[model samples]
Target: MRNLEIRQFPCLSDNYGFLVHDSESGETAAIDTPDADAYLKAASEAGWTITQIWNTHHHFDHAGGNAALKAATGATVYAPIYDRHRITDVDHWVADGDRVTLGVHVANVIHTPGHTLGHVVYHFAADRVAFVGDTLFALGCGRLFEGSPGDMWQSLSRLRAWPDDTVIYCAHEYTQANAAFARSVDPDNPALADYAREVGEKRAIGLPTVPTSIGKEKAANPFLRPDDPTLAQSIGLEGSGPVDVFAEVRARKDRF
Candidate 1:
């Protein structure tokens, strides 16, 4: 039996550090570490030794604590080779199609460059999990920092091809804000309204709005549903191609 546990460490307001653990083998890995102390504290509490660190991008908020955690736990750091120099102590530089093993489980690296030139998402097929750093989010995609809008659009499109049941572990807690934007784009979407209400209630009670399934995101996330006519019409680019619609929606959200 394969068991997956996702623990979110809230860092830098909305940034989240995700811990993935396989209880069967007592093996654990972390996706992006913004706060070393929080990661260590969580590991201690969970009684799982950190064995690996997967970096989706080289952004400071995502890879900031890599050096400290590596030194403390001696965990093998896996990162994309494009920005090897920027990330410290990358024991293994992975590319798209590369498969990494964690105990009996395996994660396939999908080089999704947009949020950064070398951003990568780790997909555990058996576990139906994907650790998508900044490239993709719960309800919104990352800002175009290192790549063009086209690059981000393509990256998100590839992610959308995954099984709808796949669970998305994004790098931030931006659901509430993103859902707000989604509601504005499609006010008639009861799905978005209901999701916003549920998220608001979760936040009100100090709960984490993460581990969202791809199906839910496709139905609720305006960024991922560019083909929807309501979103397309809202952006004044109705009947446009999917990519064009995505660009318009992204640009609008950038200002929103």
Candidate 2:
């Protein structure tokens, strides 16, 4: 099987849009439609037709462009089953373990209800790539908008099971700020420090720090390490359960 081609571009103020293409089938999918014009332009420039739209959640920024994009390209929109009521123009509803395909490339849907109650991520296991939406980020994770800290923690724990080399594509450009917050909590982590510096260098030159890997996030993101004694200690929650530790960390980040 051939590897799918991906295009990443900035949308709105901080959101990132993705286009995944399978050359063999001449099929292309818009990962999420933060902005219709942006995805349209990007697809036009790539000379690929938008054949499918995969939505990760019901958030406006994530699904707002669906109607417009679908109208323009006549593409089918696949959204999470739980949030189908919130998203318009959905042609299919997918739940955890459901598979979506772009030509020969298939992605498994993982229900990750943290940032929103019905949030999901698309994992293309064969390609070792995941479009994580807002559930996970570089050195950070999404806020508990509709779900509790425990809910978000459990959701993130699902992502932790992916292969370490899986490349994660989160939806926003919040790495620089997230790095600063990460350092404040996990101050002595060598991995976090290294990651922070690299993020700084990249942002200094206007480069994106996204497309982070499961390995890098596992090593550096405190949000993903709530079970670690060191992380728990840093938050003054020694011996606390992972849920408590995660809740404390989320609270701190909320205030950060």
Candidate 3:
């Protein structure tokens, strides 16, 4: 199978916009439209017309460019069904277990609520790639805006089950700060310390800190490691359930 060529660039100061293209078929799709002009310029320069948009949530920074991008490229917009009323100009409403296509590549849609009730991720399993939006980040996860910690933990658990090799593509440049918080909680983690240094080096070189693998996240992502005995003990939540551990971690992150 030919790999999908992914183009990622910073948008709106912190958010990232991605364009995934099937090299064999020339079909391309934008993961989210943070800025239409940036997406347009990038896609045009790459010589691929965006035929589709897969929006993960209803946040303005994530879907704000939908109208303009669709008007410019006539792309079909697909958004999570749960928040269809809030997200505008959606041509298709997708629910969990739905599949979206980028040429011959198919992405399984996983509903991940926490940051937003309608948030979803597109996991192209065969290709080992996932556009996780804001649900799962480099060293952390999104805040609880419309869902509970349990809801988000269940969502993360689902993501945690994905193939360890799957490369996670998140939507922000917040790894440096997230790494700092992860260190504070997972202080004894040698892997996290090393990963934090790597993240710092990448940022110093103006490199993106995303496309982290599931295995890498499993090791260094504090949000995904709530059950770790060391983490639980360090946070003074020893013997707590995974959900409560997650809740505490999230609360600390909020204050961090």
Candidate 4:
């Protein structure tokens, strides 16, 4: 069995640093770290050495702990080639369609630029896992900071093409609030209503609602399923394409 373990470290309030371990080879990787101490402690407890750091974007909050973690573990850092200067100390600069290996698992690097010009997502095909940072979230998406709505829309479209079973690991724990916004836009969606209740219960108990599957998000995440006529109509964007509908939903949520 391909052992894939995802440990969520709640750092800087709602931010989450993920530690992915492949037990078959005992190799571990971290995705968009915000706090080094939390990752270090988790690594120690799990008896796994962080062999690589995969960065999705160049945000300070996401890459803040990269240097420190590299110094502590001597792990190789991988990032997009477009923003090489911003990532600082990137050992391997990857681009679209590049493949990187960790132990027995191989991850395909997809150039998902939207949140940033060089943002990327790592897809571990064997494990059906994808680490999407800032581009696609549980219910909402990252604000369009460096790229246009079209750019983010295309990026999300690429992610949507992945197998529905692919487990999505986002970099932040924004499900509760995002779910609320999702309900507003898709108030009649049974899946959205159910998901909101589930997420609320999890947050109230201090549980992390992460590692959500692509299939689940497709059914309930308004940002991903903007093609739904009811959602588009509710936002006053009737017959809009996915990108336009996504922009409308994002704008409304930004104000919400």
Candidate 5:
């Protein structure tokens, strides 16, 4: 908290742009730039000079701002090695286990390849912070754009393994839609219903529903709750494996 500060803003309609700043070192980074101008405006308001661009995947919404932001701020760009062909201007192509230094903070890269074959998240373990691009959302996980349901399920588990207090910074404002899908599949889940109501109220006020804690998501997010007996049973997948249950849930969401 001392050296690291984070600012988030809306971009590209539903996408959320984030800027991370190191107070002591004065190095700030834009995470998965949904919009270059939005990131720049937020950084400018915070009086932070963008020094790095950290990309989570190759998706346009995520990396569309890479070139413009880098050109304007001369920020060093870091991207997943698996998708460097599509995600351009990456000064450092990183992979799982790679460490990136943001001033004195060290971020460990976690390769979560379900969203994309090369999707990766930046986890600053020491700071209990993670910037997960499109891999996981508030109440929902990303659509299986390029990976199997099993792949996404495994990736979610990696994030779940982190401390419950880890603050998840994900892109997008899809909680309302995800919550609706969850209730349709797991109607008896009180936790999910309660959280969904809260999300609705927040959205009504044009508030952001992100930066949710891993613990909070663990309790209410159906995508991450495949292990719950009620959730499995509601979807008629009791006794099934998490991957299988996850697949069913994702398929239902695809139509929802």
Candidate 6:
């Protein structure tokens, strides 16, 4: 089978739009519709037909362009079952463990409820690629908008179970700010220090720091290291449970 080709482009002010294409079947899936015009232009530039729209959540920037894109390309729209009522123009409502295909590439829909009550990430297991829409970021995690800290921790724990080699494509350009916050709570971590340096360099040149790997985030992301003693002590919660530690970290980030 041919490999899936992904196109990532900037949309809105900070959002990123993705197009996943499979050459063998000649099908393309738009990961989200942050901007229908942007998706259409990107698809045109790549010479790929938009056959499907896979929405991760019901946020305005995520699904706001659904109707326009569908009307333009007649593509099928797949959205999270939990967010069906929030998003419109959905052709299929997928749940956790459900599978969706584009040509021969099949992506597993995993419910990651933290950024939104029904946020779902698409993981292409064989491809070792995950499209995490706001659930997880380069050096941070999504804010506890709809779900509690406990709920978000559980969601992140599931993502941490993926193989270290998995490549993660998060939906925002928040790495610079996240790196700064990470240094505050995880200053002693050499890995985080190095990652922060790299982020600084990348941002200085107007480069995008997205598509970070699972190993990197697992090693340095403060949100994913609530159980680590160093991080707990940094926030004065040396012996607290992971959930409580996570809550403190999330609260600090909110105020950051």
The RMSD of every model to the true structure, in order and in angstroms, is: 1.4, 0.6, 0.8, 1.2, 1.1, 0.6
In model 4, state the lDDT of residue 140.
Answer: 78
TM-score of 1: 0.95
Give the clash count for each candidate: 0, 0, 0, 0, 0, 0
- Kindly report which residue stretches of model 2 are placed more than 4 angstroms away from their true locations once superposed: none
lDDT (0-100) at residue 74 of candidate 3? 92
* Candidate with better lDDT, 5 vs 6: 6
Tens digit of per-residue lDDT, candidate 6, span 148-200? 99889999999999999999999999999999999998889999999999999
On residues 36-154, what C-alpha lDDT tens digit does candidate 3 reach at each position?
Answer: 99999999889999999999999999999999999999999999999888888899999999999988899999999999999999999999999999999999899899999999999
Off by over 4 Å in 6: none
Instruction: Return the TM-score for candidate 3, rounded to 2 decimals.
Output: 0.98
Q: Which pairs clash (backbone N, Cα, C closer than 3 Å) in model 6?
A: none
> Per-residue lDDT for 8 in model 2?
98
In the range 130-151, model 2's lDDT, one tens digit per residue, is 9999999999999998999889
Candidate 2 TM-score, C-alpha based: 0.99
Q: With candidate 5 superimposed using the best TM-score fit, by how many Å does residue 157's alpha carbon deviate from the native? A: 0.5
Better candidate number, 4 or 6, judged by lDDT = 6
Query: Model 6 misses residue 198 by how many Å?
Result: 0.6
After superposition of all CA atoms, the RMSD between model 3 and the true structure is 0.8
Q: Candidate 6: worst 10 consecutive residues by lDDT?
A: 1-10
145, model 4: CA deviation in Å? 0.7
lDDT of 1 at 111: 84
Tens digits of per-residue lDDT, candidate 1, 195-249, equal: 8999999999989898798888888888788888877887677888777888777
Candidate 4 global TM-score: 0.96
